[model samples]
Target: MITVIGTGTGAPLPPDAEAALAGAGLVVGARRHLAAAALPDTAARIVLGPLAPALDAIERFLEKLEPEKPDERRPVVVLASGDPGFFGIVRALAERFGSDRLTVHPGVSSVATAFARLGLTWDDAVVVSAHGRDLRTAVNVCRAHPKVAVLTGPGSGPAELGAALRSSERVLVVASALGSGEEGSDEEGAEGEGAGGERVERVTPAEAAARDWGPAVSVVLCLDEARVLSPVRTVAGPPPGPAQWALAEGDFTHRDSMITKFEVRALALARLGPRLGEHVWDVGAGSGSVAVECARLGAAVTAVEKTLDGVERVRANAAAHGVDVSVVHGAAPTVLSDLPDPDAVFIGGGGRELPAIVTACARRARRSVVVAMAALDRVPAVRGALVAAGLDCDGVLLQSSRLAPLPGDVTRLAATNPVFLLWGVRPPARSEGVAQ
Candidate 1:
């Protein structure tokens, strides 16, 4: 049987953890984790370095166990920081080896410690991990949401996040060495020993990093007031039906020839599925109609438009609707590189490089892609590119007409231009459990 244990960040093992470790024949964890736990001198230790190597060590340990020896009992123990199940190794192990084969023992998570220090509740706060190459999602969440708690690693630690956030007005709280009494002691005493031996109060980002944090865990909290600006418009309950989407094109102020038609825009919005704490790219955002609608739905939107007049029109529409949109003046593929990875992308122009832009967005988009085309020839090319990027592709040809009053005092259908609406939903990663 496999036992997964969480050595609380900065803290020693609780009594129960010590009991579990006494029975362990083989222990798997980082060298630091093994050292912190006072285990029997004879217990076999397997050091975990990087992620791949750590996983390899666990596999090798299991393989070498003598299952056939009737008199021998082999108990494997895995050590991780914070709660093993939360952004730790337990989920990976359970996904790989199955939950039935293991038992989990959790310790106090760093998130809890950070919140405890600030005397705040975190049920509403979005928690993100910046471990390894996963910092982009955390960065985008910080950009779009008012409150976020980031678990920082070595390279992408608080300094890196602070540099990214210097422009924005956010309250940053960096708490290090949670759960460790020694690290906390140094912080408490850093202000100088007092007559009554009073503990030091909370410190800022610079002060926290200047001290030596032994066996540390750091959490960065950013707070902004702009996130709650728009009170939820729909009634305080779940949406009624799958077809009930808010903010139709009639809701926005758009120039006669500039706006994407209602039906096509609806399909594009559906594909984008904009949400709070995610970013969306509206390339060739002609009238800023798509960008405004996305921002209204709580996404941080960046509208890319090339023409000087088009950019002005987009800005006017955005202000008329009372939504914040970052208007970028540039061409596609070239302009898209510097922007944050989008949760979804909508291409309303970029006729020739539509395929290339779609490909680039596909690599970055976490959910879906939607492209609008007036020409039939571009439809197949766009669909092929999405398919090539492993997205499930689908399209619809929309033909609509508005009511026109004729000279004979009768209403007639005034046919509008035909539009091709294509969408692609990126297949879920193996870790996400199911496709969206």
Candidate 2:
């Protein structure tokens, strides 16, 4: 049988795991795990680099055991860091060998260790992995939620994450060398010093990005200190979401009828699919209603507006909803170049530059783009922009009417101006490139 043993977080290997390691004819793991275990010099070993070959080696070892001669078969042990099942090497092994033929020994995950070091509860924190994936989503989670744990990878480490979230109020807790012998070896007699080899350094995003950290960083905990005890939640990570979305016009303080209608916002949000670990841009955000709603739905949001008054309104609206939203007081099609690419984009008001803004947003949107326009003249141009960006484009004109009280006791329908909402979705087979 193939056995996977978890080896880190300062936890001692259980007796069964030790016995398995001792008897293992073939031990496959990283060099550190092998050295720490002190396996017999005679035992065959593979220093893990490219994991596929290591798995192949394990498969060969397992093949020798398939014969009817059970006595001749030798044990194959795979050592891993943290609970292998938790984004570790066990997945690949289990997939190669049937679960029935393999046994797993799990230990404390580094994420758990990091939280424990800070004496914080993680049932409410969202956990995401930037390993072998994108780091922007992890940054979005940090912006939308109070807390999150990000599993670091080659390029998606603390520095990258910190740079993305530098403008946000969240703090980066760089938990490095977790469960290692030299965790807090030299950085002692300081205010924010760690107790041992497991050191957790809390710093602002700027501070985190300024230094060059070692490769020992296993996990980084991005936290919002203001939300530590915001509320007692029954569920972990993001909450179940608001009972309803596309809040009414009266819900937000807007000048004249500048806000996007509830009907349009609802449909826009549906096309955008804003959620945790995703970023949504509300270009030309008027009163920031759409931005606030996106943030409420657990998506990191940025409202880009050129007017000073509009910027203040967006900020006030975000504050009233009790959610953090980055308010960029600048015009789009220019400012959007520097901001992180978005999973979705909603263009509410781009004025004469509507087509340019739509094109800019479409090019950067990784998933989908939705645009709302009242001027029929802008529909073809906006649709053309999305189509040019390789997004499958479609649109509909919406006409709404409210009941108005007549003089006697009768009522009549008061029609509002018809609006056109054009949306485009990137094909599932295609991947969007990040625009510098």
Candidate 3:
């Protein structure tokens, strides 16, 4: 039978785990884990360095055991650090071999150990692992949320996380080698270690934000304002109604030519349903009105503008609205490459490359894409691209007029330039499909 045992990190194996290893016939685990477990000398042992080969070894072990007599009992132990179930090897094994085929023994996860060291609780903190090639989602989570516990890997470890959070004002707490005696000790042992304890540094956000840390590092980020705690907050503005967004042009500072009219912006915001934990890209983010409004609605927004003056204006507008927006200064498709993928995207310029950028965004988007077009000639091209990328397309023409003082003590309708908004929604999976 396959048995999973968690080797409490950087510490001796617990009594029960050590007993199980003593009776084991086949021991499978990383070299470090195997060494730490201190298993009795066994004939069968598998060393796991890389992952796929380790899985292959486990599969082979199972295959060889299938022919053995049913009455014959053989103990196969798998050693893992922290809790095996948490972003660990247990999930892979369970998926490949049925969960019923194995028994899992619990041990202290690194997250638990780290928090215990700090005398903290983690029920409220978001736990994420930057293991393997999954750093993007972790980075995004840190960007969108306040309290986070990150499990680090070799390349995507604490340093990478610190670098990502450096631009923002936040607090960072890092703990490494918890339960190990090597790194001096906790406050209790500090007096004994004396001068040696001085090397064990507990860095603040400002210091950690400046340096690149090493592996075996765990980090906690506390943002300036814990906005992620609540999904949405009421901003001081007109109440939610049919007039959803796109305030009158006078509401924002713009170079007249650079601003997207309020009527069209209303539709664009509607299409781009910005919410907490989602990312939105406002390409050609002229005046930054859309990006600012999206940010107000609580979505993490990145605004890309090309011109030096336009970039400055977008920042000013965002500040005027008392919202934070990451202003990216560069041209689209090119600039977008460096930014994180979005849940929704708004293309305000670059009609020729709108199709490509929209497609790229569609491939990455978890929900929707919205593009604003002033030139009617580009609608069909953008629509075709959306359709090709498996998105349902729709468009609307918006025109609005303001009441103005006339020559004869009366009001006149001052017509504004019309705008066309094109958008697409990626179809949900088949299981989520609804009846017609």
> What C-alpha lDDT values do all the predictions have?
0.71, 0.83, 0.68
The full ranking of all candidates by lDDT, starting with the best, is 2, 1, 3
Error of 2 at 397 (Å): 1.0
Candidate 1: give its CA RMSD in angstroms.
8.3
Give the distance in Å from residue 90's predicted Cα in candidate 2 to where it truly belongs.
1.6
Tell me each candidate's TM-score: 0.64, 0.90, 0.63
Checking candidate 3 for backbone clashes, the offending pairs are: none
Stretches > 4 Å off in candidate 3 = 10-16, 66-72, 182-212, 218-278, 283-299, 304-324, 327-344, 347-369, 373-394, 398-419, 424-436
- Cα lDDT for residue 415, model 2? 91
Q: Over the stretch 369-433, how does candidate 2's per-residue lDDT look in tens digits?
A: 99999899998999899999999999899898988999989999999788999999999773579
Per-residue lDDT of model 1, residues 1-436, tens digit only: 7888876455566776677798787888756567667777777888765557666766777788778983565577888766777777877788777899788888777676677776766665777777665566676667655667777765666666666555555656766555654332111111111122112234344444454433243567766644423344444221122334445566555566667887777778877888766789999998888888787776778899998888888888777865667788998899889886788998898878888988888778788989899999888889998999899999899898989898989999999899999999988658666665
Query: After superposing candidate 1, which stretches have Cα over 4 Å from the reference?
Result: 10-14, 51-74, 95-97, 159-172, 181-217, 225-246, 253-258, 270-279, 284-287, 295-300, 305-324, 329-397, 402-436
Q: Which number leads on lDDT?
A: 2
Best-fitting candidate, scored by TM-score:
2
Q: In candidate 2, what residue range of length 10 has the lowest lDDT sum?
A: 184-193
lDDT of 3 by residue, 1-436 (tens): 6888876345566676667788787888756556656676753888856668877877877777645585554578987666778777788888878899888886677666665665655555667666565666666656544556666666665566666656666556666545553331111101111111112234544577567554335334344343334334354211132334567667788895678877788788888988755788988888888988887776778899888988999889877876668888987777777776788998888757877877777767777888887788888888888888888888888787988998889999999888888888988778656676
